[model samples]
Target: MKPMRSIILVVLLTLGLFMLSSCTRTDAPSESHSIAPSQSTDNTNDTPSATARISFVSAGNEAGFYSVEEYDGHGIVAYIDYATQTQLPLCGRPECRHSDSSCTAYALVENMSIPVLAVINDKLVIMQTEVGSDTLPHISIADLDGSNPQLLCELDSNISISPQLYTDGANLYALATVYSGSGSHLELYRFSLKDGSYESLCSFADGVNGMITSCFDMSLTLMFTRIDEESGSVEDYAQVFHVDTNTLDDPVISLTGVSEEAYTIYNSTLITLDTKDALTATMTFTDLRTGSSVEYKTNALLSASGMNSATLNVFDLWDGWYRITLNGDGKFASFNVNPVTGEFFPMTLYYEDSMNVVLIFAESGNNLLVRAGWDETRDGTTLTNLKPIYALISKDDYLHSVPNYTYIEGLDL
Candidate 1:
C-alpha cells in the first residue's frame, strides 16, 4: 500500500484546502552552533524546565481491537487476535452484518463527517465533524469493548480538528483549522477531558496549515507547506516552527533547515541533516533548551543501493530513537538511526522488507504496533490498499533487533 500521510496530503492539497497536514512521517540527526528562538532573547545557558516525553497510542486500545476508518467515513471496529493471526469486527450483536449505520461495529458517520478514533484516559473517544448536514461536530465516548457510546461534546462547527492527536491522558492536544469571516488559521487546541473546558494554546503560521514534525509534552515542532490553490502544487516552507505547549503566550522558534523532511526535535533539541547527496551530507544538532547548536559532517550509514531514491525521510521515535525510511519506485528500506557519531542499522526485526510498504502504525503499551497494507488489486497510480492488518512486537525486541512478533490476519470478507 501507499504511505498513508502522502495520500491524505494529496487529497487536502489537491482541493486547495488550508487543512492541517502531518509529518506523521519524517526524522533527524545531531548538530552544533548558535541556535535561537524567535521571540526570546535568552542566551544559550538559559534552560527552561525539562519535561519528559509524552507517550502516544493509536486509536487501538489495550483491549485488542483497532478502530480503522473507511472511505465512506465510518470507522470500522476491528477486533484483532494476535496469537491466532486473525481479526473481525468488534460488534457483539448476534446476526448482525458489520455494515450500515445501525451496525455497532461501525462508528458514527453522519452528514459526511469521518469518525476519528482516539483512546483518552482508557476511554475510547471518537471525534467527528459534521460538515455536510449540520455544523455541529461532536465527540463520542465508548467503552473499551466498543459499546455504550455517549455524547461527550459538540465542537465549534467552524474549527476542524486534525487526526494527529497527542494527549497526556488528562489533557488532549489537537491541531485544528479555525475558520472565520477573515480566513482560516491553524491553532493548537488544548482540551480538559475532566471539566470539558478547552482553550486555544497557540496559532501556528498565519496561512500555514501543515504537519507535526515532532510532538512532546511541553513542545511541538511543526512544518508548514505552501500550497498554491490555483496550481495545486505543494512546497515545503523554509522555516519550521517549534511551539511551546505549556502556556497561552506565543513563544516559538523557527529553525531554518535545508529540507523539512530532514528535521526532528526531541528532548528540547532540534536536529537537521543537510544532505549533499544520498551518500554525503552534513548533520546539525541544536539544543533549543540552551540556544546552542552544533554541526558535523556525515554520510549514509546503510548500503549503497537505493541511496539516491527520493523517498528518503527521518522521523523522531519514542525516547531518543529515530527512524530513517527510504522508499521509492520498487525499493524500500527502514532503519533505526542516530545521527550522532554515525551509529545506524537496518530495521531487520518485525516486517522489514523491500517487497511491501511496511509501516510502524503506532505504539501500544510496552509493544510497538507494525503493519503492511494489502488490496485485491491496486491502482497503479495511487497504490491504494484495501485490507489493513497489524501486529505487535515488544519495543525492546524492536530496538534490539530481536525478531519475535505476533501477527493478525485481516479478513477479506
Candidate 2:
C-alpha cells in the first residue's frame, strides 16, 4: 500500500509539470503574422499580460527613422521600425502626410523575449514580478533591439509591493503603493539608472490608490485618491502633487480638487481636465512652478439631451496640441485641444469597426500615432470578436478637409 501511494504521487507531479510547460510557451503567432526583425529573429509574440508602456526613440544608425516597442504585455517586447511616407525626415503634421505606401513597418527586436515596463534612452526597462512572492521584481536594462541585457537593481521589498517605474531623461522614478495593518499609502522614490541606488522622496498618507501620471518639462506629478470607509463611497476629491526633477525633497506643491479626468504637464504648466456636467467641462492650466492657474470653460463638450454619460480624458500632450479622448456608450472619439486657447479640433480616424477603442501613442508635430480597435457588436458586456489595428494620421488632413479624409494603412494588431 505504501509503494502504491508513492507511485500515484509521482504520476500526479509529472502531469503537473507538463501542464505548466505548455502554458509557458512563447506567444508569437504563426510565421505569416509575425514580422521577424533583424536583431530578433525568434518568434515569441504572446498577448501581453498587461498593456505595454511604449515610447518612440531613434534607431541611431538609420537617418529619419525611429522605433517603438510592441509587447504582448508579459512575454515579448520588440522594437519595430517607423518612418515617414517620404525618404526625408518630416516632423510636422503638414509635412509628414504618410499614405499606405509612404510609411514602412519592419521588426527591429523580434528574436528577443522579455516583459518590459518602459523604453528609454535607447534601452528597455524590464520588470519581473511574481505572485505572492516575497522577492521584489528585479529590474534589468536592455538595448533598443532587446540586446545587451543588464541587471539594474532589485527594488527594496517594502517599496516594491506595487511599483510603477518611470524615467525622465537619465533618472528613474518609482511610485509604489504600500499597505500595512493600519491602512494603505503611496510612496514616491527616485532611482539611479546607472547603479540602481534609490531614495524615498515623499509619502502620501491615507492614500488607498495612486498613480504617477507624468514626468515632463523637468517636473514629476502624482495623483492620489483616498477612500473613506464610513461613507462607503470614494471621496469626490483627489490630491495632485508636483515637484521639480532637480529638487525632489525641499518643496512639493500640492493641489486639491475634484478627481481629474486626465492631466498633462508641458513647459512647466500642468493642465487638468475636470468635467462639470453633460454639456460643460473645464480645463485648468496651472503653472507648477508659480502656482498661477487659468481655467477655460466650454459648453460644446456634452451631448444635446444633456444626458451624456461619456467620460472625457486627456490622452497625450505633444508640442502645443493636447489629445483629449471621449469614451462612453458605444463610440469613442479623440480631439486635439490647444491649451493656450481652449480650442478643440477633432482628429478624424477611419474606424475599421464601430467598437469605439482608440489609443493615441505619440505625436511628431502634426502627425499622431494611433491604435484603434473594436469588438464585435456587444451582446451586453461580452464581445464576440476582437480586432485591433495601428495607423498614422495627420491632424491637418482632418482639420482642413474632412474627418477620415486620409488614412495610412499599416500593421494590424
Candidate 3:
C-alpha cells in the first residue's frame, strides 16, 4: 500500500512539472517582448483602411465663340456648342443690318474670340460683341451661363471702332482707332467691370498699329507693336506698360525693335516671336518686381505664320512649364514648353477650329482649366461651325472636360 501511494505521488509530481514548464515558456515570451507605449496605443485606434478624400470638377471651354458668319446673306453670330456640335444664333434679322450688302457684314473672315476668358471672384467675364455701327460698338458681359449679357460698356465715340477686348482677372482692356486727317491712330483703354468705367491708358499718333493685344493683366503689363505708317512696316519696336488700375495714368514704356504678332507672359518673362522668319526669336523674361530682364533664344517649334492664323496662347502649368496652343488650319495642337530650358514638345493633337484659348489657374497656379474651340466635322479638315472644348489637365496628367463650361475656376463663385 505504501509503494502504490508513492507511485501515485510521483505521477502527480510529473504532471505538475509538465504544467509548470508550459506556463514558464508562455511567460518568457511575454517578458521578453517589448512594445512601445505609443505603438500599443496606436494599435488600438489605427485603422488599416484609412485613405484621403478626392473630388474633381469638370473642365470648361476656353474657346467660347466660333464661326461668326451671316446665313442667307444676313448678318448672324453663329455660336457653336463644341461638345454637342450644335449652333446657336445671335441676331440675324434685317433690323440688325446684318445683310450681305451691309458694309459691316458678318463675314466670319476673322472670327477671333477673346484670347483669354477670366472668372474674377466668381464673375464670368468673357469678351463678346454685337453687330452694330462702329459709332455704337456693343460689348457683352454676362455670367458663365451667358445670362444677363448686360451692355457693360460701349467703345469710345471718338474711336468709332471695336478693337479686340482683352481681360485680366479684374479689368478689360481694349485697343481702338480714331481717324485723324492723316490716318487712323491707335488708342488703348481699360474698362472696369466693377464700376463700368472706361479709362484711356495710351494713345499714339499712328505710331502703334494693329489690334492691341495683352496677356494676363494690364497690372502685369501689355505688349503692343509700334509701326511706321509711312512704310506700312512694323518698326521692330514694341511697348510694355504697367497699368495701375488704382490710378488713371498713361502706362506706356518703350520696348524697341521687338516685333512679334502674338506673345504671352509667365513669371514676369515675355515669350515672343520675331516675325522676321516666323520663329520664336528670343524669350525675354522680365521680373516686374525687380525690374530685371533675362533673354534666351530657342529653336522655333511653330512658325510665326503658323502661329498667326493659328491662335498661339501660352499658359504656365505649375510644374515649371507652359502648355501652348496653336489653333490654325482649323485644328488644335498642344505643346509643352520647359520654362527653364525653353524646350517644346507636342502634347496632344485634336481636330478643331480653336478661335481662342484661356487657362484658368487657381491656388497660385496649382490647378489648370483650359478652354478652346471644336468645330463641326465638315470636310475632314475645315470646321463648318464653331464650338467650345473645356479641358481640365490634372497635376497627375489626367484631363477632363464638359460640353459648354467655356470658363471656370476663377469667376465670382
- Among these predictions, the greatest TM-score belongs to 1
lDDT computed for candidate 1: 0.51
Model 2 spans > 4 angstroms off: 1-74, 84-114, 129-136, 156-164, 179-183, 230-267, 271-275, 278-281, 291-294, 301-312, 323-334, 347-357, 364-366, 373-387, 398-413
Per-residue lDDT tens digits for candidate 2, residues 285-378, read 7876678888755455444214355565553444465555565676565566676776776655546544332444434346544444432446
Would you list the C-alpha lDDT of every candidate in the order shown?
0.51, 0.41, 0.37
- Estimate TM-scores for all models: 0.67, 0.58, 0.47
- Superior by TM-score: candidate 1 or candidate 2: 1
RMSD of 2: 15.6
- The backbone clash count of each candidate, in order, is 15, 10, 24
Residue-wise C-alpha lDDT for candidate 3, range 295-330, written one tens digit per residue: 644335555224544434555454556565555556
RMSD of every prediction: 11.5, 15.6, 28.9
